[model samples]
Target: MDKVDIQASNANILKDHGSDNKLNVSYGGPKIGRYVSASSNISTGYLLLSESPVGSVLYKDKCGSHCVYCFSRLVAGYPCEACCDVAFCSPICRKKKKASFHQFECRYQEFLTGLGISSIGRLALRLITSKPFDYFLKIRKYLNDTNETLESNRSLITRNLDVIQFNAHEVYEFVRKDNQNLKPSKQIAIGLAIYQRASYMNHSCKGEPIFDNYGPTFYFKETKDRQKELKDRYWFNCNCQACQENWSLLNDLISIPKESLSYNKKLKQDSFKDLIHFIESNYVDGKMPTESIVRAIDKFRTVCYNMGSVHYLNK
Candidate 1:
């Protein structure tokens, strides 16, 4: 056989294909091999396991509050649930990486569910709904019209939940402890560590992580003194606009009950008048209304309003 055929035959022979490892597993998109063995270049006894980020959120770095020109938000259009939180594709992955910052947010997983959103999906919705120009315009207007000092505005922003600040050392340690049982190379720590190599990412004042065209290979650095350096190397340390006021936003979000926002059952049962208009205006070619689509539009409009898009579009 030719080289191509031989290579194909070898791959077929070695491929796990339908093995238990492959079946009923939480695989998404494609699988990337992990780094299991210790590297002499950075050995420190901690068994290191590295793999590309998965799910929509962290794989895409959709965590944290808002940035004025958050490219991910513009693209994905909502708060990124998966990226915002270190969501794993499988329970095994989640259990393996639980020691990281995810522990802090995992407690609030129910809140995320209430919105019927995933981290990446939320980011996408926010982006789809945002009007960046108008958002900036409002920012300028608030500055021009109000006599508030820069510090006061900053405080207000901080209180509003535009940004999110976290303790990186705690997050790092959490992951290390949580994944102790997993195979050395199969463990993940932070959202950033999900990649194989993490040197290429550039920090942004208004950007989120991106992974297109390239196969997954981003990873967090395996530092010997991880907890010590974590504070310094954390993705965000300053009072960036997103974290300053993000808590308030989170509070506001939590105030709303999930059942109040749900449409799954009611959409099938109720027949409201505006539902018809919504279907005619926003749906595929204004086809006859279905309860499901109407409910979807309602949910979309709520998301648009929350991300400050509805007002932008109105203007």
Candidate 2:
């Protein structure tokens, strides 16, 4: 999919707990669920969640010219005087981040960069440094109320620190593997972030909401991931519609003739936009038979692959 610059999108969509909003975080067993607000009726491609970053870390190698705070790419950025690795889009963002997490992280830049810590590890540090002990206590209390336990012994801060360390491995495996260009040191810094509400989302190969990150902000879209990756990283057996009915099963059910199913079929205009339009207009939104929908998706995937547009599969 096209990398969404979430920084440029509608800002209000990420606001917390707005009355007219389409997204709401609700309790559902061990995990939290982000659902469409009772009053909202979202269409097939609608965005279901937008979360602002509570804490974030930049990939050291890939983000030299990107703003360390907002993550906006810049031809040239104002470098942090304290650490050569960090830069920012504006003075305000730099100052704000510094006052929060960077002050502590700045001192350990060399060690952090050298150790090649995973992004989640960096995020755990950021969480500990940015928020106070009391903050963690409040969070612990809130979690405990929901039947979740964040055990700690000496103090709330220590307890929360332990919790972060424990959960880092789980979070680390889920880090996206798409940034192949990152050098070893930079790879350690690969995008890591935490948004309070966004963390609770459950796994689904055909998850209705997909998120794109631009710095600390995430833009949500309706879309779909691999079952093995989800289970391996997130520790859940996916029962999403796409996983339950494997693509092979769907492919067999297509009512369209074999000739029509061929990707080599001639089109008046063979272009990505045209193919997408054809599929959406003809098969999306349950407008066609189930088999036809499956066929259209298969055709779309084939066209995308042939055109070197495999990114579309993620959307």
* Candidate of highest TM-score: 2
Q: Please report the TM-score between candidate 1 and the true structure.
A: 0.17
Per-residue accuracy of model 1 over 223-256 as CA lDDT, tens digit each: 2233235345443233322233332221122222
Q: Where does model 1 exceed 4 Å of error? A: 1-51, 54-94, 116-118, 121-315
**What are the per-residue Cα lDDT tens digits for candidate 2 across 122-204?**
77677778876567777775553543455555566455444443233211111222333111111123355665544434311
Report the lDDT of model 2 for residue 251. Answer: 35
Cand. 2 Cα-lDDT: 0.49
Residue 265 in model 1: lDDT: 35
The best candidate by lDDT is 2
Cα lDDT of all candidates, in order? 0.30, 0.49
Error of 2 at 270 (Å): 15
Runs of candidate 2 with Cα error greater than 4 angstroms are 1-26, 30-40, 132-190, 203-225, 249-281, 284-315
* Residue 91's lDDT in candidate 1: 44
